[model samples]
Each structure stands twice: as C-alpha cells, then as structure tokens.
Target: MPDRNSAAHRAMAAAVARMPDPVSYQETALLETDLVAAFGTCRAVAVSSGTAAITTALAACGIGEGHEVLLPAVTVVMTVAAVAACGARPVFVDSAADGRGMDLNDLAAKTGPATRAVVAVHLAGRTDGIHDLAAYTRATGLRLIEDACQAQGTTSGGRQAGTIGDMGCFSLKDGKLLACGEGGYLLTDNTDLAARAAAYRTHWQSDAPDAPAGTHLGVNFRLAEPLAALARHHLTRFPEALAQRREQAAALHRAVDGTPGLEPITAAAGEEPNGYAALWRLTLPDPRAFAARLAQAGVPNSTGTHRLTAAHLHPACSRFASGDLPHARVTVDALLAVPFTEHDTDEAIHRRALTIRREAVRWTR
Candidate 1:
C-alpha cells in the first residue's frame, strides 16, 4: 500500500497522454454541448478556465464599469478578478454561520440601487438557501449568476447546480470533478446570452469577418481542443468518479462524527454534489492556530479558491470592496478541502485521510 501510486497522479498521467494535438473545433462544440446537457435546458460555452468562463458570462450579461455584483467572500479570487476584469464592482457577502452557503440575511442587507446581479456561490457543493437567494433577486429585479466552479454535479430540488440560475459558471482546474488539468465553462438557457458568450470565446469574431459590430468587448477565452478532448474522455467516466468521491466523503463524515473543534456539515437535504471539492467550514476557536495544528497533523491538503485577498494584496481597485463581506472573511479563515475522487486512489489512503482529520479535531479542543 505504501508503494502504491497516488490515484490522482495516475489519472493525471493518463489524461496528459490523451491530450489531443491541434485542438479541434468540432470536438470543442461536443464538449460544450455535453456540459450543457448534464445541466439541462442550458447552453454551455467551454472556456480556458473557470475564471474566464465567469468573466465571459459577466461581460455578456452587459455588466460593465460602475455596475455592482453581489458575491460571497468565502471563495477564490478568480471570479473577483473576472468581475473586476469586466469593469464591474464585486460586493462581498458574508456566508451563513453554518458556513455551507451564502448568508441571505447579509445578502438582502447588501442589495442596493446600483446592484446589477447577485452571484450565488455554491461553495463546497453546499447550497445555502440559494433558491431563496435567487428569489430575492427575482423580486429585486437583479440578474442571478451561479458560481459552480467547485460544484460540478451539485443538485438542488431536481435542478442541477448551474441550471438553477440565470447563468452558471464552472471550473475544471486541477482539482475538480470535470477536470482536464485546467478548463472551465459557462452555461445558460438564454439564447442571446449563449450567443454573446460564444462570440466572446473566439476573440469576438462574428461569422462575417468585415462586420465591425460582430464581437462586442470580447476576449479570447476559448478552451483548447486538447483540453476539451480531455474533458470528453473524463466526462464519460465522471458519474463513477463522483460516486467514488461521495462514498469517500460519507466515510470521512462518519469518522469525524462528534468532533467539536472541526464540524463537517452534510449536504443540505435534497442537495447532492458531484464530489469535486469536499468542504470543511471552520468553527475552531482559533482558526489559524487550528489550521497549523491540522497541517502538522498531516492533513494532506488545503484550498483558498474562494477567499478575499488581503487588502494590501488586492489591486487598488479591489481595495474598496463594493459591499460588506464579514462572513466571507470568516469562511476563508476556516475552509478546508480533501482529495475526494481519483481513478485508482488506494482505499486505505482514504482511511488514512480520515484518521488524520479526526486527530486534528482532537487537537482543536
């Protein structure tokens, strides 16, 4: 068991070998359609990365300089950059105490006259009253953008994670269910939105080369044919990969039961994840201290995909977060992720992982 290869490492090697040469346009469409099909009633536009997907979606939605968007502080900086990249302002919202989803109470409090959209982050595959969050936008007349970069196959009430919003953005970075080392996609049911997004992917080239009006403020964010090919090869096997991940999450959840310093919240009722990122929202007395202990305890990994950059680290433009995001800060301080699914990860490695986490919980107290 000790000499066995990491399941993730092996899958990476195989996927690398499968990367297609001279990425194909036809294959690109196939991958895009498949992404949309999984989500139902939506069109998927595959892009270079989830960050690109979000930026393209935001831009196509007509958001621009001076526009404001509602987002959670508990996530990575890519979408924040996407929003900023499109010349919009990102208003950070604090997540709920449970650390599973956005804090709607905070979101309602933050909605303002200049708000253009509310971006619901399905953080760690945890949906925090996203339905209610979306409804709030419906009543307020603001657009809804779903950030599912970490949520590949998440479902809420028979609806896929990305399908439940006006537009959905996903990531296929090194660590995701739909991963091909690095890739991302945008999905939407709105035909016009899909058309706009598609145009943005290829440097805004309209079918007519001479038309100056073809691409409006677009960027070359297209996903490579080879990566899309990688996506095709793995998407076929995703169902099984997700199942394996879910099964492992169940085991880790059981093993950590009754641990106080570390609390692992389960999927909200009727919500199922594709097993991409298994989140542990921290409630430790001293999160930083606990994290250090956890690291020393041999916790194999960690993540900061959806979190705020230190004010000093952020671009001067981001220094002034358009909205308040206290809970966002809290979630960032406590979030933890573990490798959930890989082709042939040793079953024992899974147990060892659980044991390490349980020990960290003991140290938390």
Candidate 2:
C-alpha cells in the first residue's frame, strides 16, 4: 500500500497536470483509438467501471430473463450479480483441477438449453487455460464472454486473451495495469456485437435517425473524460510497463522458489504472463498467521480479490450455485500477491520478500 503511488504514476500525474477539463477532454477518444489500433477493431467502448463493463456487455448480448450465465464459481459476486440483475441465473464452473480459470468439465456440465453465455475469467494476468475454454464455447455454440478484467497483458499463444472470445470485458481498476481509478472496456471483432454494446452504455444514439429502441434503455455507464485521458496516456506506456511487471514477477520467483510448503503457479513457455503480481498466491495451513507474519517482516503483500464460495456462503448461493466448489477452498490456503508498484523493480524489493518467505518457509518445513 505504501508504494501504490509510484514514479510511473507521478509521470502520469505531471502529464495530467497540463491537460484540460476531463469533461471536455480528448483523451477519451485517443485512448479508444489507441485501444482499437492495438486490438484491431472499433468495437472497443470505454465505460465507468468493471461491474458496469460486465453488466453492459451482458445487456448488449441480449442475456436476460430465463438465461443461464456460466462463470467461474470462485469469481467475485459481481459476475453472478450481473447475470442476476438481468433476471437470469448464474451457474458456476470451478477452476480446472490444475488450478487455472474455470474448469472445462464444470463448464460443459452446467451449460444447458438455457445457457446463452459463458464468462471466461482469466485469473490473475495469466491466460494459459483460456484456449480450451474458447474451444468449448465454440463447440457448444454458446457466446463467449472473456473477463480479462485482471488480465490486461495476458494472452494465449500470440493472440491477446480478449480477442479470442466472442466479446471481452476489461477493467482498468485501481489494482489493474493502466488503471484509471475506475474504468472498463468491451472488445470484439464482431460489428453487430460492437454496435449493440456501444448503444448499451449511453442514452441511445445512432447515426440512423431510425435507431432501434435498444439505445433508449442504457444506463450511465459512460467513462468520464478525465479518466479516459489518463487511460489514454497509460495505454501508450503499457507495452513498456508490461515488460517491467514480468521482470518483477520473475525476480520474486527466483527469490522464493522451492521454499518449503509453498506452491507457486508454474509458468509455461507458451503461456507468457502479463508481468504482474496479482499472483504468487501460496498455500499455507494458517493463512491469517502467515499473512500477519509477512506483514511484520515489512514485505509489501496482500490477498488477491474476487474470491467467492458457493452461494451457500450467502443466502443467494442457491441462486447462482448448487454448493461451494473446490477452487474457492484452494484459493483460501494462503493466497497473497507481492507488491507490483511500477516505480521500483523487484530487485529493489526482493530482499524483504525473501526474508518474509524464508520466515514463512519454516511453517511449511
């Protein structure tokens, strides 16, 4: 938390200082253009927040009453809530037994006649497991919605995570890469899908004077101009910043590798990560004590968010899931993310990390 404000952020602040009022800002258009240029489509539309991004995308896709939305059971409630808000059911798929994204087996099993869409969440910034999910969506004839909100720089093979799905939603939340306090975007290569989502965020406007009633039902999910400007500036620096995040994560891997009682997610060559630390989640017997110990050691770290149990944990669990699934439990066994503040390299921060892990290593030993 201490280093959340970093040199990269200060650089951005300086640039923002010279900017005009956010309401009339031009960065919104520029960032959208940059996003389109990088992703190869104008289907990219910015919105107010990640939840709004997911909900707007859901609304645009025509998912509502009587639909069953399949998503990771271990995800934040927002994914399920978005579906429920549309008067649909939220079915859950646990992470693969290997522990990455949603399990294909559950996805296959839960998808039925009422299943209209699947929200494929890319946990952390890694997307190695999404290819098969994409294939599943294709085979089932279900619409694929990639939740790459936590996966800004993630990809499968050479293709970026969002591009492979029928439509993808990304959040530029405070903890995300290229964050703009709270902002989001929906991406796709499909033109009709693009038009539908664009109209879903605003008060309904189309070039055609005879635009459908679809435009009239939108909420105020629009991104503010100031946020868009910062997002635009940050987008320009993302390619370079991404390289640094990879560097930071690698350093942590080296500093803490093979430490007793710790299980790090192994990175494969084909599955390059987005170079961030919303990962490094370890499994320990007593998570609370371990987290406390790490804090006492002066290592900057904390738990990753968006974890949930079966809706049984809440009265509404029955509404979205039959029971709590395995990964939700697997996720609780001491998941912690190393600090990835942009200003400092992992080299500058690794000693404290090693010291913390070495201390915690005893519990595993």
Candidate 3:
C-alpha cells in the first residue's frame, strides 16, 4: 500500500539503500531490540511470519513429534499449521460461551497425557479470563503459549499478552495493530527458552563458529531488515495510535450500550483491551439474517460467516473430525465483528453505532 512519497516507502527505501550482501542478524536489527523494550519482555526473537514465531516457540518449549498441543477450535488455520509444522498433533479445544477466550471446562476435558502445552489465542485483542487460563496452565504443569497475534498492544492484569504465558507470539502482518508488511516476533522471560528461540530462528546458529549447533530443527525464519525497520518506525507511533483506537471504540460501545437484542463484547476483569476490533453478541435469533440486515442498513458485519469458522472444520485439519465443539459452534453463530479502526472519525463511529442499533431493534420486533 505504500506510494513513492509515503513515509513507509521512504523508510523501506532507506533500509534498502543500506543493504549489504545480506541483512545481518540482531546486530543491526533495531526492531527486535525495540520490541523487547516496548513489550517489557526480557528477550524478543524476530521471525519471518507469525506462524514461524509459533513454530519457533513450540520448538523452544520442546513440543515436537508425539506431542499434543491444545488450542482453541475457533482460530486461524495458521495456528494449527504451526503445530503440524513441528510434527505435533493439534488437539482442538472448544471456545468460551462469551466467544472471547477458550472454554476452561472444555480445555480441561480435552487435555490429556499427550497434551504438553496449550496455545491460548487472544482473539480480536480481547483477553478475557487469561489470568485464570494462566493459573490453570501453571497448576497443570503444561507450557502456555499466548498466541497474541491479534493482541499486540493488549494486556490482562497489568501484564502484556505475550509476557503472561511461557511464550508469546505476535504477527506484524498488514492490518495488525503493529504491522511490518510481513513479520513476527516471539517473547519470553525464560533465559533458556529465549536463547533456544533465538537460535531456532536462524538454523540454530549463534552467528559464530564456536556457537551452539541447531538444538532444534528450524528454517530460515529471520525477519528481513527492511521489514524490521518498518516495524520500528510504526512502533514510534503506536502509543498515540492505540489511544485513538480506544477512544473510537469506546464511543461506539457507549452508543450501543442499551440497544435491545445487541450486547457489546467486553473485556474481562482487570484486563485492558486494545480495541483492535468491535464485536457484538446477538441476543436475538437468526444472527446470520441479522448481520445481513445490518449490511443493508449500511453497516457490514463479519458474522455467521466463514471468517471465524471453527478451525476443526478446515480441510487442512481433517485428522480432527468435527461435531464436538459445541461452545465454538454456538459462539461463532451468535457473534458479529463490525469493521473498526483508529482512522474512524467520531461522526463515523456514532453513525455505525446508530446503524447497528436501528437494525438490531428492527429485527427484534
């Protein structure tokens, strides 16, 4: 999306102008260093993509072949692909009733001897019940991985999303809160795990002859210098950007506060959401039809659609047959995601809220 005169274009061009035979790792990668400071994590390991970050994190945690990693059924396919990439089986866990987090009971039921870790996805920047999930993982002795791809700037109980679990993965893909065109990074406080992930990111080499050999199998998942530079520039504007998004989302939530047949999805106790996306849980019947009505009223919604389908339903995960994810199925059917961003003006936010309220009331009657 960058044009010749755009700042991103210039930053990338400047980065390209400094290119040597190849981009050096870590030494000149200011982005990863900045991420560690920004996210308050002890270490950050940049990777080619968010999925690569997950795979690296899994490898760092020793989750490999014959291991079972539990993850929400309502997640992007790339999440499961990360597990499969490690030759580990992805055990699908049902979603919570609120549709913002995983169902604890379902997670308990699905966890078994093969379950070595749990991937708690903070869907849409909402981290409801993450504290409880973290406690559960600690009690059960399972490694916790927070797939905070959708929650880059979000937090729960005063802790950053990625820092709460054993390992946190973030996506810098376009459209994300902290995008870099295409990149990702893993964060963790565990010294050993951090070193393991750093090495895994680049064929497990220490960039020196006497450096440790690849402790875990890995690929060339290094974050390109241009992308890292772009990420660093974006970070400079993130605080202001986050504040603007929260303000707009708050205005919209207030407008629909008491609208019948519509309830705004909220953050859990002690959690500060990033307001990356606006979600509403329908209290009326026929959610798919309601979403259609909303679109007709000039407010398009991603509801009862394929965008948030159950991951088990995907062909790539065919090994895990469907029909057991009751909570996920129900939540997907009733929830709707309205388009939102920091760019929306106050007037636009109010108008979208009004459109939602008007259609919700009309459908209820």
Q: Highest TM-score, which number?
A: 3
Write model 1 residue lDDT over 1-365, tens digit each, in one string. 32228887566545543544222388788997787666676677888998888888887788889898888776566667788898888887777776656778887887887789988776666666778877888899888888888777778887888877788998988768778988898888887777677766665553213222232446778788888889988899888777877776666666665666566656788888765544565666666556555556555444332223422225653674654456555566666665454653556556645665676657655
Off by over 4 Å in 2: 1-26, 207-216, 278-283, 287-289, 292-319, 331-334, 344-348, 362-365
Model 1's lDDT to the true fold? Answer: 0.70
- In order, the Cα lDDT scores of the candidates are 0.70, 0.70, 0.79
lDDT of 3: 0.79
Give each model a TM-score.
0.82, 0.83, 0.85
What are the clashing pairs of model 3? Answer: none
Residue 102 of model 1 has an lDDT of: 75
Question: What are the runs in model 1 whose C-alpha is more than 4 Å off?
Answer: 1-24, 207-215, 279-284, 301-318, 322-325, 343-358, 361-365
Tens-place lDDT per residue, model 2, 151-227, is 78776688886888888889988867778888998888877777666666764443113345332466667798889
Root-mean-square deviation of each candidate, in angstroms? 12.1, 11.1, 9.4
lDDT of 3 by residue, 246-325 (tens): 77667778888788877777777888888777877887888877776777777756653335567877677779654678
